[model samples]
Target chain A: DAGITQSPRHKVTETGTPVTLRCHQTENHRYMYWYRQDPGHGLRLIHYSYGVKDTDKGEVSDGYSVSRSKTEDFLLTLESATSSQTSVYFCAISEPGQGPPEQYFGPGTRLTVT
Target chain B: SQKIEQNSEALNIQEGKTATLTCNYTNYSPAYLQWYRQDPGRGPVFLLLIRENEKEKRKERLKVTFDTTLKQSLFHITASQPADSATYLCALDLSRDDKIIFGKGTRLHILP
Candidate 1:
């Protein structure tokens, strides 16, 4: 319970369509991350933000993009949704110099691409 | 390339016994290792974090041990209960970057 919330907890879209998921947090954490979890692949980081207007790609950033215009929000976008991109996306937040430096996750958003 | 691996098979254990899960990595040294527990249809919850300098850490019935020399970490749950059954994930923070890498996770089942 990181005081985080993700919009559209469940979604369905068609291939080639664009989609965006929103993650909001009330913790005022400095670090926010987006990860997708799929069977056999585990959870792969798509992107992360260190601060407002500061972001970086992760291991699997090929078809995805992220933005953080405010400290309390991080958005993940699929420029062109594909069936292969279907996964349960999770949002996590961590505060620098915090107790254990471990990330706290939100509920998650399940996306299905047809 | 850096890689992290964990037992993919579900681990079955008897209630009241200790269940141990292993996480191994290669080609990377992490500043710390973290463990998370995930239930079905939910996001992972943070469990424990062990630094390179610390050999072990404990919280109640859960214990985590990190061995940088071996590039491995072990997570243990003592006096296991059916409620403790879930997928356990091990993660490592990149030494040179702010990113973190996670293992595939191991499913644990505590049977009565």
Candidate 2:
């Protein structure tokens, strides 16, 4: 309900294929994050962008890349999709410098690699 | 590595009763803790945040208690209703940064 949207709610792709997931926000937040959720592992951060063209790797950054060219759009790309990469991906945003600012998440995208 | 934990068992209680959930941490001391409610097929919604300096926080029917000494936090919902059934997750802000770590979460159900 925070004016955040994710594209391709569900997708199925073959192994070794490249896939890109998009996240757009109308709130103009400075912080954008990409996370993957799996059974028993909960959610783990993949990458985050603090400002336009300023991106950083997270706890789990292998095989994943992200870009923030504009203020509203943050893109996550899987260089080579694999069956292990199949999981629910979520995009989140937060306003920096706020008092322990809380992140607002998008509905999420489910990806399956065969 | 810092870790956060919550009881995995689903908490069951009668409607109009108070429901309590616990979150514990290890190897890392946090300055603040957060609670979030997640429903099936949806992202989590922020519920409450408590600072280490503060002992407790209350918002309407929801209350949270933070004890740094014990490295645990308690979430309570008074006058619980059937609509409150969902999985509740707790998060902690890591030292010196705003990065957050989350728990697996505990599912809650309110019986009518």
In terms of lDDT, the best-performing candidate is: 1
Q: Which is the leading candidate under DockQ? A: 1
Candidate 2, residues B15-34, lDDT tens digits: the string is 99999999999998787899
Model 1 chain A: which ten-residue window has the lowest total lDDT? A95-104
Question: Clashes in model 2: which pairs?
Answer: none
lDDT of 1 at A108: 95
Q: Give the chain B TM-score achieved by candidate 1.
A: 0.96
lDDT of 2 by residue, A75-103 (tens): 99999999999999989898858666788
lDDT value for model 1: 0.93
